[model samples]
Target: MVLNELGARINSALQALSKEPVIDDKAVDALLREICGALLESDVNVRLVHNLRQNVKKRVNLDELAASGNKRKVIQLAVFDELCSLVDPGVQPWKPRKGKPNVVMFVGLQGSGKTTSCTKLAAYYKRKGLKVGLVCADTFRAGAFDQLKQNAARAHIPYYGSYAEADPVQIAMDGVAQFKGSKFELIIVDTSGRHKQETELFAEMEQIAAAIKPDNTIFVMDGTIGQAADAQARAFKESVDIGSIIITKMDGHAKGGGAISAVAATGSPIEFIGTGEHVHDLDPFSARPFVSKMLGMGDISGLVETVKDMQLEKNEDMMKNLAKGVFTLKDMRDQLQTILKMGPLNKLMGMVPGMSPEMMQGFDADESTRRLRSYMSVFDSMTEAELNSDGKLFDTESRLRRVARGSGVRPVEIQALLHQHQQFGQIVKKMGGPKGMLGKMNPGMMQQMAKNPGAMNPNMLKQMGGMGGIQNMMKQMGGMGGIQNMMKQMMGGGDGPGGPGGMGNMQDMMAQMMNGMGGMGGLGGLGGMGGMGGGRR
Candidate 1:
């Protein structure tokens, strides 16, 4: 089974347990059986699966908990905790310091995506304002330096490599020295891939490590390797001190559980996982959030962090407009643009609560991207006056036709965009009145929520329609039919053949949900009104 299937099976088991009228031993045993079966099918080690079952059984004593009145909660928590422990190595991965050079060395067999991961890590740090540089030390593989060079250039990260340098150790030393001398904060050294039986190559790897001591030696393991990852990880650990691990190619239909469980057994924490082939696909690994997202229980903190990275709160004009409950056509355009920058649409949707992968069926990410770009074209064709206006100026057929001709889009599409803008405008208007949610919030409180979306204040939640309001919002997004309706509206009432709408509706629905929950404070950073108005841009 793949990771998604594994998560779904485990979730189904937990839901079954939740539905049981009586939490009996039989039900608990059935739950354990289901979870263990899923894990084993996903290539998780038999021994680890047994241990997880035993641990959950020991943790949840049904008879003892019968008096607690929360037996279901206890049992579910035990399962969640054990699953987290199954993947966690209990070791903290090394972090790079800001002022000094932190060397990260990559090691794995050939075809493990080491070179790409190096560039991904560099890009990740580069986005965080760190001076990161890449070093291509893989002289063993043909065209290794070229691959690293092309990747580095695409990511715009500085790199050092040699076409003539045949000695991998020498290249590693020289590259590290050059980047360190240049005062680069994070220097990643990519070494040649080697197998366990290759004694000579292992010796060469040891020589390179001696030349330039890496602050963190990451074992880049292929997630598709299944249970064999355990032995490979142990072999690499025995050869050199592997400080951390990065499991690559996890986005596919690979049986990744075995690799993850195997690596965790080696006591080297997984620092990151390559989710896709894209240069920005490396996601920092956190055991809890990983399991939560896998179980379709959205990672709110992770979502907030992603939004924070975009620095949407820095858009002063957008924030001010939102405070006054104003969402103009230009604001909608900017939000769409920000969504385009926020990476894959499916990935974003996965971060939201109640948005399970099953609910995202038929959502085409690439098509949604094209549709968003098309909307941008329509916005570009509009005059500044129209962009700043409340979208009423486009009511004239001539004006609509002029924009449609200019943008090369159907008039219906432009009308769709205008209608979407009107919906947002109405929501913003409600938030502006004296009795509105935004009107009730103080400026300082709004700024605080904007800065840290995850840390929602209790008073803010109460003022913004409280938990009850959030529950109602969730109901609107809980079903496929609800999501389909929202998509239809955003896609201009299915104007295109077979309805071109996709996850693009998620942005609008999320914005509307935030508004319905009293104001745009909840998930506003992602909706687009800067930090606390619409949603993430």
Candidate 2:
């Protein structure tokens, strides 16, 4: 079974136990059986699955627990703990020291995405205010340096490589020395790979590892390798003390369970997982969240991290402008870009409670991204004065035609963009008036809210807006379960909760923005949108 199917099966097993009239050993055995079957079907090692089942069964003794101790909850926790242990080696992951030049060496077989992974790692750190540099030391693979150079350039990361350099060790030494002199904090060296393990491959890898004295040597494994990942990881670990692992192509792989679990066998914690072909698709691996997602529980921690990583609080001026209901076409453009930078829409959606990566496929995430780009294109075509003004500029047919022509889009499309802007304006108007719903939100609570929306007390939600804020919104939308159903319908291109009559798109967009704002003081920056409608004229 695919990972999603495995998750559903495991969830069903747990739900079955919850529904049992009385907790009993038979029910527990049945639940464990179901879970084992699902894991085995997903290509998880049969022996590992057996161990998980035995461990859970041993811990969940229904008779040993008092009536006060919930048997169902205990069983569930046992399952979660075992699953986490399966992927976690109980080892500390290597960290990059800020002041020093931390050299990270990447190793893997051919087609394991090592070169691309190097760039993705560099890009991840570069966004975190680090001076990241890349070194192309993979001379064994023809055009490896060229590929790294191109990726580094696209990500705007400085890199060192010589087309004439034939010796990998010499190239690695020179590149490290150069980047160290430049005071680059994170220097990633991409090394060569072979199709299969050979003495020569291991020898070269050992040589490079010794020459660079990297802080971390990461083994990049192909997620589709199934149980074979264990052997590959062990082979690499034996050749060089692989400090970490990164499983690649997980988005399309069915044996991700096998790949991830196998890495633990090599005693190395997985640092990241490549979810897609994009450079930003690399996700920092956290065992609890990974197991949580696998069991159909959303990655709440990951969602919060993504929001905090955006550093939305740093835009104090924009937040102030938003509080005054002064949202402009420029502000809208910035938000659109921020949404893009927030990572893949599907990935973000999967972080929501009751949502899964499989279910997110229906969101037409790629289409949503394309739509945002088209809207931004129109914004780009507008004159500075026009962008800074309200929707009045678009009211002039001549101006509409000019922007449409410049953006190479139809006037009707431009009109659609304006309609979206108008919807946002109305939302702001409703929430930012003198007695606006969002006026009472506390700026100090923004960070706390972003960390975990579910933990936000009802009073705090009420302060952000009337009717208990997000809690009320979730209730009216039928809670997370109802939200899933509504999303499925919306994904099918039907009208949303705001009805089919023009308000459907606006309702969806507002819900989206609210969801994104969950941890950002729950609408702290949206306090001043009431003046937006007035600004347009």
Candidate 3:
């Protein structure tokens, strides 16, 4: 099983037990067996999988537990905790200070995506408004500098590399000194990789480390290597101070579990995981959110970070208009643009609480993007007044005919787009008002939002799938806790005036929840605003 399949398998096992009235030893053993099988199949270290199974079983302790114990919750929590421990080495990753230059060195095998990972890391920090520069010291590879130069140019990031230099150590020293002298805050040095572990490779790696003295030396392991990742990571670690790890090529790698477990064995924390070929596909590794995503529980923090990274908080006018449930053709176009900026549709879907990767397989990214473009074209064909209106002008036959002819699309397609707009507007309108349902939602995020003016208004919540999305989220949070109580649980089960992080009150919690929602660049998927109810009338 792959990572997605592994999570689905565990979720299925737990879901089966969730439906049972009585939790017996036989059922518990069966569930553990299924989970263990999934983990083993995913190429997790066999010993680690065994330890996890035993730990979960020991913690459950069905024989000693009283009748008062909620057996299901106890088992679920145990599984959750053990799963978190699977990849967590219980260590802190390297943190870069704001005012100082943090030189990070990248190392891995020849085909382990070390160069691309370096560029991706640079892009990650670049998106955070940091002064980042890339240094290509992999002179051993034929086109290493060219590749890094091209990637750096495409991302508009400043880079330092020497095409004439054959010595990686000299180039690394020069690059680091140059970037540091320029006051670059995050400078990444890319090192060469050999076909196999050799003395020359280790010597050069150690020389580069000594030359630049990087604050973090990340071992970029290829996730497709299965159990071999353990040996490979250990070889690199024996040569240098491997401060962190970044597992690459996990998008569809069945053996990704092995690489992750292998890193855990080396006692190095995983800083990130590359999920796709794009620079933005690099995700910061967080244990709980990763496990939650694996179990179909969603990664709320990842979603929020994506939103904040996009700087969506600057759109105050958009929030105000959305709160009024006032959506026009122009607003739809803006939403479509935001969706495009947020990245792939399937990726966005995987971030939602109840959305599974399997469920999102049906969404063809290219087809959907073309469809969004067609809708934008239709809007372009409309008059300025019509575009700004609530699409009521399209109700007339002549108006429809004119737009269809102007946009070179069928009349029915135009009607379908209009109908979708109407549905969206209606949903938004029904979400909240001065005396409506907005008062009853997750208050923690809402509290966070209250501090940031225009980050999330009541109207914006309506724009985020209205009540349907919230209900779906509540259902995924075990259905019985309700929004307020679930908010409490999400806030680390705290009480009194403030919850975790000094949340002022229930209103503050709601604000925080709202802020999180607003920061979700993939809000369209989370709110169920996708599909638009079909393509044609």
Candidate 4:
């Protein structure tokens, strides 16, 4: 089964239990059975799934819990904890420190995406302000160095390799020495991908490791390997320390459950997962958040981290205009650009509280990306005055036609862009007036709000339609259960009544939470832009 389908099945079983009028052992057993079945079908190890079942049963005493009430909550929590345990080995993965060279070695079977993942990891660290370098030590595979070179060049990361250096060990040592001497903070050595039966290659791997003494050795496992991932992980772990694992090809219809479950065999944490082929497709993996997103609960913390990593809050002009309720076309364009930078649309949607994978089924990520790019093209063709203006300059047919001609976009598409900008402008207008939420807040509070929307006070809650209003909105979103719990966790309520800050921060929080989400394609507006014809030039 696909990973999303596995999540959906497990979620469906949980939802079924939630609907039960009476909590009973039979219902709990049914839920566990369904969940276990999903895991097994997804190629997860049977032993792990069985242990998960027994563990949940041990934690939840439905009979005793019946006396205390909230039986469902106890059972749900138990399941969540057990699922988290399946992937977490209780060992913290190695981390690279600045001002020193952190050597990271890559090892995996050929075709497990080891080379690609090396570049992705380098790119990920580079994005975080680390001076990273790549060393291709895979002399066994033809074009491996070229692949790394092209990928490194495209990502603008420094690299070290040689066509004449047939000795992989020498290459690894020379590369590490070169980068370390150059003061690169993170030096990643990509080793030749080998099989378990390749004794000489395994010996060479150990030699390379001994030569460089890497701080962290990541085992790149193919998600599609299914149950075989367990043996492969064990094999690689035996060969090296296997400080961490990075599962690749997760974006495809791979049996990711097996790869995730394989973490138990190696006793290493999954440092990252490659979601796609893009240089920015790597996601830092945390077990709880991974399962939460898989189960459609969303990862608010991950979303917050992504936003902070992008430093979206540094746009002082946009923040000032937002405070004054004056959103211009330029601001809208800037948002679209940020969204494009934030990675795939489906990935962003998964970080939202209510956007389940099932809900995302109809949204084509490629189409949405194309539409966003076309909108950008439309903005690109506009004059400086029009871009800085409130988009009303396009009211004249002549101006619209001229822009349409220049941008190769239909006039209607430009009109659609204007309409979307107008909607955002209206929302901004509501935020700035004397009676508006921003108007009531001081500059310090506004800055705090931007930094953490979940920290809003009760007065701010009243400004945004109250707790009831937020719950109603979440319900209207998809009728998916557990949104309230998700919201509470997002707000750092930690099992409090009505969550932290009374749900007042939901609207303004979501608005400021993911500037990319609110600003990108205007939430639902991107879907309505059918074809976005003639805007591709």
What is candidate 2's lDDT per residue for 359-410, written digit by digit as tens? 6554666776665576678888988998877677777799999988888777
Count of backbone clashes, every candidate in sequence? 11, 5, 23, 1
- Please report, in order, the local distance difference test score of every candidate based on alpha carbons: 0.76, 0.71, 0.69, 0.74
How many backbone collisions does model 2 have?
5
**Of the pair 1 and 3, which is ahead by TM-score?**
1
lDDT of 2: 0.71
lDDT of 1 at 477: 36
> Whose lDDT is greatest here?
1
Q: Which RMSD does model 1 reach against the true structure?
A: 4.6
Quote each prediction's TM-score: 0.90, 0.84, 0.81, 0.86
lDDT for each residue of candidate 3 in 319-408, tens digit (9 for 90 to 100): 555445455677666665666677764565465565545554444545544555665677789898997888887768988898888888
Clashing pairs in 4: 461-504
Deviation of model 4 at 101, angstroms: 1.0
Clashing pairs in 2: 323-528, 325-528, 325-529, 429-530, 450-519
Model 4 spans > 4 angstroms off: 442-537
Q: Cα lDDT for residue 102, model 1?
A: 95
Models ranked on lDDT: 1, 4, 2, 3
Supply the TM-score for candidate 3. 0.81
Please give, for residues 362-404, the per-residue lDDT of candidate 1 as tens digits: 5666777787787788889989999888888977899999998
Q: Higher-lDDT candidate among 2 and 4?
A: 4
